[model samples]
Target chain A: MPGWLLTVWAAVVAMVVVFTFLTIMVMFSVWMERKVAGFIQHRVGPMRAGGFHGWAQSIADSIKLLFKEDLILIGADRKLFQIAPALVMATATAMFVVLPFAPGWQVADADLGVFLILALASVTTIGVIMAGWGSYNKWSVYGAMREAAQVASYEIPLALSLIPPILHYGTFSLATATEAQAGWGGMQWYVFSSAAPVAWLSFPLFFIAALAENKRAPFDLPEAESELVAGFHTEYTGIRFSFFFLEEYAAMFVMGAVGAALWFGGWNFPGIHLLEPGSALLQVLALFAFVAKAMALVFVMMWVRWTVPRLRIDQVMTLGYKYLTPLSMAVVLIAAFWEFGLHLIQD
Target chain B: MALPTPPREPARRHHYLGDILSTIHSTAKGMALTMRYLWRKPVTMDYPKEKPVIDQRYRGIHVLDQQLCIYCDLCAKACPVDCIEMDAVRHGKEIEWKAFTLDYQKCMFCELCVYPCPKDCFIQGTEYSMVSEDRNDFVHDLLTWKGLREEEPS
Candidate 1:
């Protein structure tokens, strides 16, 4: 086969894999969210759907949502309303392509992997805004505007916090960044790296900013269900609503995966360096390790969502600009100086 | 003594470091408490799968002992909602059974009809989960042997 054909073939295969992973992850996250919420609240959530604590509850819900009557509001911009969910879901799928699942498991190893993910991630807010404008509803407009501002504001801290790892690894490719961190078993993971002790702050900063970016609770003013009645998707029904729902979990997984790859050493478990290289078992272990780390980060997001009450919109803004942005910038600066001082000592 | 005045104004307080510290402390405490509860059993029952511990004295659907019941109308008269109704025929010394229906739609399950039964035959059972699509299902017949000859004195 020709190189272009091979590239096209590879791209198609990669998309299928990523899309499947994203769907399964979303289903699992949805079920996990209910279970976590139920446990925290001292109640059982979804006991009957496919039994066993309703592990298949999300599957049942997806089936229900798929068959739900698709409602398009009168006076709505039909074109934009229909396309917004597709846009959101598309961006999420695009972002997942850049994430390094294992050594060769990524859909695309773009040199600007993190940058591409970040850029694509922000485009979802546009889709959200379009959804808001398209719906022509007051509550949806509020949700859309909130999402626009929140994503815009949180993007600063989110990108800022990532600089420490980017600086340490000195690479934009997430696969390269992950490979650079695989040393000393897992001790050399940037969080515990002596080269940049301040990078520890960056992970927490990134996690919190990512929460706001994903519109998880404490930063979930966009879809404040009690106040906004499902927010930008208020006018949406059926598959379109589920598309938006799927996008939320997909975004969360991508953010968590990025966090894992950068700060937590993606696919690099304890004593992994001792394992025989270029073996099938090694690849499987690497995949498991990366997923485990990503899931842990996702778990923390769910945990925090249940733990903290939703922040007021103004409070969300204040935390993003005042606390997180400044804090992340400080971490980045301090990390740079630490590297500089280490270089001088070596000379 | 002078009447104590309730403060009219909300207290204004701002201690950034202390506030931040306390916020962290309180959030950590709350998360810890919830974490403990996560492992602990849920207070709520599964409901359908697990039947609740119903009290012995609790009034539920009426369970009438047909063998002990006399055809006296005292129980029906004591009902506040007038839900209870009974009829029987006198055949010499023995009574032939007839309709004895209780309209649960009007029956309050107040134990009023149960208490006024002369033979101590009628009482409330703990079963509460009676469901039916038909409205007439609420109107339950207390007698199992409606116009029966088996319990008749020979």
Candidate 2:
């Protein structure tokens, strides 16, 4: 194949793989949510349907949802209402283009990878707002406005948290950041390094911000079912609804992968040298380990969702602005001073 | 849940450096938990392939024990939905009667009728997968309960 054709083929394969993985992950997340909810309420979640703990429950749900009538609001802006879900899904999936599962495993290692992912993620809010606005419904308008404000507010803290690592690594490339953490010891992880105290603070700051970004619990103001009756996408049904669902899970995966790369050291492990000469088998194992870590993070996100009650929109904003933002700033100042003082002493 | 009002204070902007440090701290705490769970055996049980032990108190389908039942109207009256119907004819000079019908359609499976029966005859079975094409199939009669008891010499 020509070089350009080969690149295109690789991109296609990567997209397919990520898309499939995301679909499975979403199903797993649904099952997990039910199981978690059941346990919390002292009930059994889906014990029948395909047996073995109702593993096929999500599949059945998907099939049913696919056949359900697709509804468009009669008074809504038809074109935008119909296109909003696709926009959200496309933007969310596009984020995976720059995510590196392992070295040389990314679809497109763009020079502005971090910025691109962050920018694309923000597009989801636009789609959500469009859904709300175009629906021409009061509830949807309120939901879209709340969602826009919530995500926009949280993005500050989220982006700020990422800066410490970017500063330390001195690159915008996620692959480069992962490569910097490659070593044989856990202490070498960016989150543990002495050079950047800010790196430690970024972890929690980003985590809370990520929850908001994915519109998970405590920050799910946009779709507070009790208050908004399905939020911005209330009028959406059938495959359109599925698009939003898939986007949410895909966003979850992106956040988890980004978190793994920035803090835990993407594709890096203690005493693992598959990347070294003559260690192809070790390299493969390490690649799996990288994915496992990302999935593990995703699971934790699910756990948090089930554990916490949703915060009100205002409270969500307060958390991002009043609390997390200030804490993150302090950690950054301390880290900068710490590094500066060390340099002076060494000189 | 109510949507709370937005804060009056201006949004705080964190120093870019500090955000990363906190993320690391939180993730470590999170990872510690997941690592603990990963080593522990999964609580999931494969459904169709494996049957779980159900508690004895589990409420399932109801079965009626006819022989022990007396032709009393108490059970029929106690039924809230009136799904249970009983009929009896005076037999031999002793004036004994027998015949009972219970309709599952109106049955709420409340077990109220089972408890009030004077004969201590009604019982609930573990068969929960009862399905019927015709509504009439749900209606069951207990005429054979007496015959079975006679053969048993009880």
Candidate 3:
């Protein structure tokens, strides 16, 4: 195969694989979220959809959404309204291109992986704004505005918090970052690295900021159903609504992937060096490690979602600006000084 | 000749780091509680697959003991809404049971019918699942096999 053609083919294959994985993952996460919510509230949720505790509930929901009649309101900007969900879904899916699941498992493996992810994540804000503006509903516009402001402000802290790991690894490539953690038999995962305890601040900072970026609970002011009635997607129905749902769930996995790659050592496991990277067993184990770590983070996100009440919009902004942003900046400085001091000690 | 005023303290001294630490502690505590319950047995009983344990005094469906019931129309008369209908045919000395139906649409399950039955034939059984597509299915025949199976011995 020719060089460009091979690259194109690889890209196509990766896209297809990622899309399928994301679709299935979103479905599973939806079911898991319901079960988690049910358990938290002391109820058995979705019992009879497929069989044995509603295993097929999400699939059934997807099927229902597929067949549901599409409702476009008279006030809606038909073109932009139709495109908003697709835009959100596309941007969310595009983030996976730079996210490294394992050593050889990334889609694009871009040189500037971190920058690409941050950029793509922000693009979802545009989709959200379009949805709100296109809907022609006051509540939808309110939701969209909240989302725009939240994502825009939270992106700063989110980006700042992730930088420490990139600095530690001294590269923007997620694969390189993962590889960097492979030292010290994976004991040197960036979260625990550096003698400076303040480097640890980045973990929680990144998580909270990521949660806000993902528009998850506590920071979920955009879709505050009590206030805005389903937020920017209020006018959406049927398959279009499902697209937004897909994007949200898939974005969670993307957040988990980025977190795992930057801090938790991606697919690196202790004693993993004994087996060759080419070995099927090693690859499987590496993949398993990566997935388990990411899923654990996702579970924590779910846990936080249920534990905390939604913050008011002002509170959300206060958290992002007055707290997380400053805290994250301090953490970056601490990491830099720690690295500098460590080098001096060696000299 | 101005009056002396007390110095104002530094705006109540906000504990930024301390607040963050406490927030972490409380958030962890909340998450721990939810996590503990996540593994615990769910309070829900799968309704169709698993039946709930109903209390003995729960007033659900009505049961009638054909053998114990006499030709007394007392239960029918005692019904507040005349939902209970009963009839019997007499052949010489032995009485033949003809028809007995309870109109569940109006039956309040007050156990009023039970108190008036001299033979202690009327009872509120625990069979609460009374779903049906037919409107008249709510009118339960006390002489049917289902009704007889639900009969509790006095």
Candidate 4:
């Protein structure tokens, strides 16, 4: 193959890989969510779908959704309604372009990886708003407005919370940030780093903001089934409904992947440093370690979701604006001083 | 049931720090409770596959030992809803049993008829499944066998 053709070929393969990973992970998350929710409520969820705790439950659900009628509202802005889910899904997938899965396995390790991810995530809100407005329903518009308000307020704190790690790593790239945490057999993760208090404060701030961004519980006003009637995706049915669902879990994994790279030492594990660098075995092990870390964070998201009840819209806004934003700003200030001191001493 | 919201705190005492801290405290407690339940056995019974251990005194459907019934009309008369009906043909010392039906739709499983039975042979059994598509199917015949059986006492 020619050099340019090889580049194009590699890009195609990467897309296929990421898309496959996203679908499988979303399916698995759905199954995990049901099982976890059931376990908490003292009932067995989906016991006989594919046997052995109903492993194929989500797969069966997706297949059912696929054959369902693709409902399009008569009063909807047809263009925007049709495009909304695709836009949301695209942004979520785009975030994976910067996520360094293994040591050198990322599709595109952009210099502005962290910044680009944060930017793209907020764009998902625009797609949501489009869905709401385009649906031509009062309830859908309310859901959209609520989502806009929540995401706008939460994004500030979410972005601010990343400053400590970004400052410590001295780069905007997530790969660099992750590599910096590889010291001390992966014990030097940001939250436990030299700037302990700042990183510690920032982590919870980041996590809460991330939860709000993802529309997770205690902050899940948008998708409040009891009150909202399925929220922004109310008019969506069939495969289109599944797209929004897919976007949600995909976004969760992106958040988890970003968190792992930024704070939890991406692919670095104890005894990992002993392995030969750049070796195929090392890369494979690193990929597993990285994915395991990310998935653990995703599991925590599910655990918190099941544990907490949905917050009212006002309360979610209050927490995002009043609590998280101020706290993250303070963390950022301390982080700046800590990094400055480290820079002078090391130089 | 009406849900109890958190008590509204006065503005003087309601600082963000304290409120957030209390939220965290309560959330941790709730999470720990759920986590404990996660490891505990699920309380759900797999119906159709695993039958429940019904008590000996459970009032389900009536079971009549026809040979011991003695053709008394007291049990049928004692039924509050008048759901029980029976007839027997006399053949010298032996009795030939006919239909002994109880309309379960009206019977109520109250065991009212059992107390009036002189022979103590009319009683409720623990087989409680009563599902049917036809209305007449609910009018259950309590007798396991009709007419005089070989096992019946002469």
Candidate 5:
């Protein structure tokens, strides 16, 4: 085969694998969320569909949504409205391409991997804005504005907090950070180290920012259903609606992956040499481990979602700017000073 | 006696080191809770394969005892949704009814029909899975006591 053909084949294969894994992950997460919510609320979730505690509920829901009538509004901007969901879904799903599931297991291990993921992740907000504006409805426009503001504001603290970790690890590549943390000792994990207090503080700051980033609860003012009536995608139906759902799950997955990479040591496990670059089976197992860790974080996100009532839009802004942002900056300074002091003491 | 308000501590400034330590402490607390629950038995049921035990008083589908019905329209009057429609025919020489029809489509399953039946003919059953694509499936036929006697004799 020609080199171009080989490259095309590789890209196609990569797309197929990523999409399949994302679909399975979303389905499982949906089922798990329902089950968790049911247990917490003292109710039984879907039980009849495909048995085994409604294992196929998500699949059934997807099929139902697929067959439903696609409703488009009369005054809606036809082109942009249709394109908005596709943009959101595509951008959110694209993040997984650069995500390192395990050592040497990423589809594209670019040097600027983190930057690429962050840039692609921001596209989801643009999609939201477009969906809101294109709908020509007042509520959707408000929702779009709120979502844009929330995401844009939180990204400041989120990116700043992330910087300390990169400074300590000395690389932007996710795989390199994971490699650095590979050890049985607590010192190997960034969270436990004394030199980087910012990294430790960043965990919560990033978590709060991620909630805003993904539009999860407390920061979910954009889609305050009672007020905005389903937010920016209120008019969307059928597969268009499914696209929004896909984007939400994909964003959640990306947030979880980023959290693992930055704070919890991506694919690194104590006493685990199985994640070394050479063995394919080990790489696959490590990838599974990485996903498990991500899903665990996702579970925590769900727990927080269920536990807290959403803050008002202003409160959300205040929390990000007035509290989280300044706190994160202070942490960065302390971490920097601590490192400097340590160097001076040694000298 | 009026109680004096407790003296408040001076407004603590944001300390980066203190905030980092506090965040770590809180996260450790949260992780401890999560770890504790992770090993505990899941509160999930295997669902369809393992049916939950429902209470005996749980209301389900309604069943009519044809032999005991006296062609009275009490059940029809008592139904809230008006889902029940009953038709009765008296045979040539008898005061008792022969044929009867009851439409289940409008039945509210409120147990009102069951309680008001003069002959105690209506009863609620445990078979709740009565979903159907066709509306006609909801209609039911009840045999009169006379019809049962006549069929037996024949």
Candidate 6:
């Protein structure tokens, strides 16, 4: 086969693999969140759908959502309303392309991987805004507006926090960042790397910001179900509604992968480097490590969602603008200085 | 003692550092508590597969001891909503029990029917689950022994 054809073939294969992984991950996350929420509330969450703790509950839910009557409110912009979910899902899928799952497992090893991820992730807010606007409902409009403002504000801190990891390694490539942190078994994971306090603090900062960006609870003013019926997707039903739902789960997994790649040493295990990179055992271990870290982060998100109450819109804004922004900006500066100071000492 | 003066304007106290510290502390404490609960066994009973332990005195469904019943009209008369209907044919000295139906549509399961039975033939069993799609199912026959065991008499 020609080189170009082989590249296309590989890209196609990667897309299939990523989409499958994402679908399974999203389904699992949905079921896990319900179970976790049920456990927290002292109730048994879905036990019947798949027999064993409702293992197929999410799948059942998706099927139910798929067959629901597709409703469009009178006076709604039909075109935008229909396309909004696709846009959101598209951006979410695009994010996975840049994410490094394991060594050589990524779809594209873009040099500007982090930048591409942040950019694509932010585009989801646009889809949300469109959905809210196209719906022409007051509640949906409110949800969309809140979602827009929240993501926009949170983006600052989210982007700022990501810079610290790159500064530590001096590369925009996530692959390079992951490779740079290798050597010290698991001790060199940036979250535990006492290169400076900023290195340690960046993990929490990035995580909290990512939560807000993803519109998880405590930062979930957008779909505050009690307040806004169904939020931005109030007018959507059937497959369109499932699209939004799928996008949210996929987004969470993407953020988890990003977090793992940047701070948790994606796919790298203690003594993992000893094995040849080309060896199947090493690849398997690497994949496990990456997935384990990502799942841990996703689990933490679920835990925090069930544990913490949703924040008021004003409080969300205050947290973003007042605390997280300044804190993250300071972290970036401190991390830069730490790098500079280390360089001077070595010289 | 003189009445304590209402604090001039309620003490104005703002401890920024203390507030942040407490927020962290409370959040951590709450998360820890939830984490404990997360690992602990869930309080939920697998409702379908397991039946709950019903109390002895709980009034659920009516059960009748047909052999002991004297075909008295007391239970039918005591029913506030007049849901119970009992009919018997008298043949010489023996009263032949005919039809005894309780229209549960109006019967409140108040155990009023149980107390008024002169023969102590009627009692309430601790069985709450009765489901039927037909409207006629609501009316239960006392003679047929609804929610009762044949070996165990009242």
Q: What lDDT would each prediction earn against the true structure?
A: 0.87, 0.78, 0.85, 0.87, 0.77, 0.85
List model 4 lDDT by residue over B18-57, tens digit each.
9989988998898898888888789998778799999989
The TM-scores that each candidate's chain B achieves against the reference are 0.86, 0.65, 0.78, 0.84, 0.68, 0.83
Clashes of each: 0, 27, 0, 0, 1, 0
TM-score of 4: 0.88
List where candidate 5 sits over 4 angstroms from the true fold: A185-187, A194-197, A274-277, A342-347, B1-97, B101-139, B144-154
Write down the TM-score of every candidate: 0.94, 0.78, 0.91, 0.88, 0.79, 0.93
lDDT of 6 by residue, A1-347 (tens): 99999999987887888889888888898998898899888887889997788898999888898789989988999999988999999899889887776788777888999999899888999999999999989989999999987886789999999998898888888888888777686547777664647767787889999999888988888788999998898888899988888899888888998899888888788998678877989878888888888889999999999889999988888888888888889889999889899789889
> What does the interface RMSD come to for each candidate?
1.2, 6.4, 1.0, 0.8, 5.0, 1.2
Model 6 alpha-carbon drift over 4 Å, by segment: A1-8, A194-196, B1-17, B145-154
Q: Interface RMSD (Å) of model 4? A: 0.8
TM-score pick, better of 3 and 6 = 6
Question: Across residues B2-120, which tens digit of lDDT does each residue of candidate 3 receive?
Answer: 98888877786669988788889998899999988887888878777788899989999988877777768998889999999887777564556668899988988888888978878
Q: Candidate 1, residues A167-279: lDDT per residue as tens digits?
A: 87889999998888888875478787766467776788888889998888888898899899989989999999999999999999999999999988887888887878767
Q: Candidate 3's residue-wise lDDT over A1-347, tens digit each? A: 89999989987898899899899989989998898888888887788988778999999999999999999989889999988999999998898888777778778779999898889888887898899899989999999889977876689999998888877778999999899888777667777666427556788999999899888998878788888889998888899999999998888888998898888889998888788877888888888898888888888899889889999888888888889889999988988887788789889
Q: Is candidate 1 or candidate 3 better by lDDT?
A: 1
Tens digits of lDDT, candidate 2, A64-124? 8899998876799998998899999999989887887767878788877889988998999
* Model 4 Cα shift for residue A225 (angstroms): 1.7
Clashing pairs in 6: none
Q: What is candidate 2's local distance difference test score? A: 0.78
The TM-score of candidate 2 is: 0.78
Pairs that clash in candidate 3: none
In model 4, residue pairs whose N, Cα or C atoms come closer than 3 Å (at least 3 residues apart or on different chains), thus clashing, are none
Instruction: Give the Å shift of residue B3 in candidate 3.
Output: 30
List candidate 1 segments past 4 Å from native. Answer: B1-18, B149-154
